[model samples]
Target: MKFSYDYIKSGNATCVLEMGKERFEFYPTFHSDALGDFVSYLASVHPLCKLSWKEGAFHKINGGITWETGTYLLRWELKRDFEDLEIKITEWQNPMIDRKGDSQLIRKVLEAKCNFNEFVLCVVKELDRVIKQRGILGYRQEWQGYTFPIDGFLDLKYACLYKKPFEITKKNNGTSLEAELNLLMEKMD
Candidate 1:
């Protein structure tokens, strides 16, 4: 995740979440510089060590852990010990955000015992990718959503992705993930 925000405008940006030796990409509403701020939010929110820098890259930008069917599943790995954390699209909540239809998403996060700062990180972290290559969302991960995280209004990018259904070609592993996610959601419900 290299940042050239000095030249880049538009609140929209892309991110690669890394955990222990794994990485995953998600679309964010900010530039590359924002990735560190984003990761700091994760380190503070999730039970993890302090996230920092090792010269240029994130010291532990390695892999990600997402909640699929209530399980902390490891889906990808990183060049470093850490993997990228991801927002599985299977858990997108924009419909609910629309239903609430306001900054109610913010209130939702507060209700979940998250402070304002925490909510911001969650919002950024939960953002879905509009993969440029596919022009659609991909690999939805149904992670746990905090209580009123969506009430405070959302960035249009994240909000809009949820308003429509984005699917992938049948040949890719997309179908497998969709099917598996459906079963996971059913059992979770």
Candidate 2:
């Protein structure tokens, strides 16, 4: 699986998810920092690996994007068994559902299974490219609603590289991951 996001305008982006031969694209509006929300969701779930003794066997997270006609939701379901992780991606279309828990008679746009780590790495690589192209301050100026979620992005990247789930408390407390990412970004500038 491959994921990438492209900034289209001041407050809009196109997120693309490619799984083997299939490619799905979504247009997410910056109603409340769409990229931040999406990355935060990923960071929240990245710690749920079965290898982590404190984590669970199954987990689910949902995120929504405003499409041209209706709202499109990407539902991520993660199931882990011992050493394997399976990620299920389901896209739904509904005109009335705008938030994560909102439910209705939705149209199923697509459904597929993909690798969890690969998906995370793809997003990490793409986001790194975006940050390189648009500096951190520039991203905040263009993204508008909220600043880029460097904390979440770095947390996930560290987890992927080290092959371990990051500590939620540390991330929430702005300790390890946030501090390291801040120092790295400062060095870059």
Task: Report the number of the highest-TM-score candidate.
Answer: 2
Candidates' C-alpha lDDT: 0.28, 0.61
TM-score of 2: 0.66
Considering summed lDDT, which 10 consecutive residues are worst modelled in model 1? Answer: 105-114
For residues 1-102, write the lDDT of model 1, one tens digit per residue. 211111112443344434334444444332122433433334333322221112222234433322221111112221221233333222223332245444
Tell me the lDDT of model 2 at 69: 21
At residue 114, what lDDT does model 2 achieve?
58
Error of 1 at 46 (Å): 11
Backbone clash count for every predicted candidate, in the order shown: 55, 0
Q: Residue 170 in model 2: shift from native, Å? A: 10
What digit string (tens of lDDT, one per residue) describes model 2 on residues 55-152? 44223444432333247655555454444445555556553556664465455546565566777778877777777778788788777766877766
